[model samples]
Target: MGRVVTLGEIMLRLSTDSGVRIAQADNFCAHYGGGEANVAISLANFGHDVYFASKIPDGLGEGVVKHLNRYGVHTNFLLKGGSRLGTYYVEAGIGERAANVIYDRAGSSFAEMTESEWQKEELFNNVDIFHISGITPALSSSWKKTTISLIEAAKEAGCKISFDINYRGKLWSQKEAGETISEILPLVDYCSAGKLDALYLLGIPEATEQENELVYYYQEIRKKFPAISVLYSTKRTVVSASCNELIGTLWMDDHYYESQNHVINPIVDRVGAGDAFSGGVLHGILAQKSPQEMIDFATAASALKHTIHGDCNQFSEPEVNSFLLAGSGKINR
Candidate 1:
């Protein structure tokens, strides 16, 4: 297994029960999650040597460390400092009612962390893959610089960089995200972005009506950022708040590969499915799987994630493979 590193915030997630609106909830189920942290957990479940790097409030951070350890993610690089860990709220949806997320993460420990706080030299030691997302840079001006530096340092340490353009409109504007992400793309090896990101963030022009829109955008992206060896995204059709049709796509070796559609009904939770997909793809890459295999595995992992209640994909690699072989809703016995 490869040694992987993921850097970002690990937040406390307080979510309401299904059909309970945030305002009406007197009780909530608390879980711990964040974009990069979620990815770390997934990679760990896949049997990779994964380390998560970030800071959290000293006392309150114990639970966070235990959570990561429970999932097999190493917390050696996790620093304990700052005033508070980040927290967010989720209102679970039912049927056609969509879920909602409220970010109360401003001034959190990870956001306030400085470059000097990290043990940079030791952090990247023998790391094979480094994963991060756009969300870290969106936190603060200081974080933006730190994110870029971390990427550069990882690259110098011979780690393949996997970047997910996990854009959050709540955190930063399109113009700002666009500018920041553009700066980071040239350093990225594997990228996760969709049509909207291509058009809005990367500033790729709209494809002609006759052209395959997503392919055109990806081609344009490759032309502009040649360092990106792999580009991937998902096509999701929302049937309702509880049902979705998802397809994973990959662009590699000058070819576009797609996974079969997965029709997910009665989704238990959808918050971390994308991160799960990203983790699957990274795992596939590390395992040297073919493009088609990678996408298939990734899509299946994502589908399984929708059945779980928390923001982390709890399924292991063998479980994901079993799901692929048996398909959904079949009795194992």
Candidate 2:
């Protein structure tokens, strides 16, 4: 396999215990999470050589780097020595309301990065694939400039680029997100996002259920951004806070492939499931698996994520395959 590089910020996630609010909690589980980093970590866990580029405060950054190294992610291109580490507080929610996230990322190292912070060769030197997300560009103006510079540099390096919409409402407004994403779409090779995210970034009305909105949205999105040759989407139907049917779909060369929805009985953690799916698909592609296998593996990986708490990329391939094989479909994997 070749090198895969993900460009983004890795924040220290402080998550409250189940049913506990951030203000009321005395203890929280600490973990590192970022859309690009999450995908990179998952890919590394699946045996791919992966690297992640992000900025962190010297001390906290060192810890994050060590953690990534433990996960087999190359941190050679990471930048350190900043004042503060970005953080987010997550409170697990049940029933009608979804999980809540509070950001404390302003003035963080990554957000303060200038265009020079993105050294092309350091990250994309030997990289075969480069992955980025909308979340990074939405962080701040400087980050937006860095994201664009990195993408252009990756293209010049002859590497494939994967873009995940990852539109976070809390990060920016819909109008600005749509405009910015529209501008960057032409530079991306492959793209993925949830239906709502695409709709938000593309300013399209929500498509009807019978229309298979993901395919419809992808078609519409590709029309404007012809360079995006491959598309992946995760379809979700929230049954309750603890239950949902999650499916993954892939669109490439004008064909659509769908995966069976794995019903999550009891959701342990909602974060990083999409990144897990992206990881599985990218892993399948690197392994040269058929589209069906890619979607199946990706779906299985995501289903397993919902069973584990705190961004579960520590999973192994045997674990994911076990979930796909056994009738139990539980998280033992």
Candidate 3:
């Protein structure tokens, strides 16, 4: 696979221990993650040449690169400037309770990055694909301009654009998200987002019938952006904080491919699992896998992520394939 470029922020994550509340924890476990950074690490872990482009606080640059380097993501495109790195806190919840996230991203270097500070064409060197998340543009108007310019540069370079509509209601309003995401949809060759995102980002109303949502979402995207070559999403049934049922769906060439649902027990962390799915699907695309293979590989990778602790998907490519071949530990008639 050719080199892929991913642009977005990487934040400092301070997470509370299992079954703990954010306000009660005296100490926290530190990790770094963000939508685009997680995607870059996922592709890199799958043995693809991935370039992670972004800005961090001046002194924090080295630490950020170190984390990406540990995962094989190339950090040559990184720039530094802001006063502090963006940060988020996670409270890992238990059964019947959902995990909680608190964001502290304002005035961060990535959010403060100007269009002139980034040399898009130069950063895009050797890039075959460009990936981004909706979270990037929601940061600030300046970041929005930077994202727009970056997408335009990628399009000019004939690189495929991959977008994850990772809607964060805490960061921006639905109206703003819809407007911003709609602007970039025309340039996207591949898109990944779930039901709520479709509803908010594209103004698609929720289907009263649950089974119809994914297909409808796919149809609406094609209706809105005929240029999109592929659309995919993951369906998850969270039985509890410690367990989830995972499946992946893909739409391409007017056809749909759905993977078998894999049940995960004792989930370690759900943080970066979606990004893992994004990486796996993109990996399958780069490997020229069929639609069925793509969704299967992706869902299996996501299921495996639930068994690992931390923000990164620690499973190797071969490990993911092994799990895929294992048949989701259940047979459907």
- Report each candidate's C-alpha RMSD, comma-separated, in the order given: 0.9, 2.0, 2.9
Model 1, 1-333: lDDT tens digits are 899999999999999999788899999999999999999999999999999998989887999999999999999989888899899999988787889999998788888876747767798999999999999999988989999999999999999999999999999999999999999999999999899999999998988884567888889999999999999999999999999999999999999999999999989999999999999999999999999999999999999999999999999999999999998899887
Which candidate number maximizes TM-score? Answer: 1
TM-score of each: 0.98, 0.94, 0.94
lDDT of 3 by residue, 1-333 (tens): 768999898999999999789989999998888888888888888889999888887776678889999999988888877798989999997788889999988888888776746677787776888999999888888878778888989999888999999888898999999999999999899999667877777887777766666888788778989989999998888899888888899998899889997888877889999999999889988888999988988888888777777787877888788776656554434
TM for candidate 1 is 0.98
TM-score preference between candidates 1 and 2, better one: 1
Best by lDDT: 1
Off-target runs (Cα >4 Å) in candidate 3 are 205-211, 327-333
- Single out the weakest 10-residue window by summed lDDT for candidate 2: 324-333
Candidate 2: stretches off by over 4 Å: 204-211, 330-333
- Which candidate model has the greater TM-score, 1 or 3? 1
User: In candidate 3, residue 22 scores what lDDT?
Assistant: 92
**Candidate 2 per-residue C-alpha lDDT over 3-120 given as tens digits, one digit per residue, 9 for 90 to 100:** 7998888889999877888889999999988888889888988888888887788878877888888889988778876799999989987777678899999989888776656556
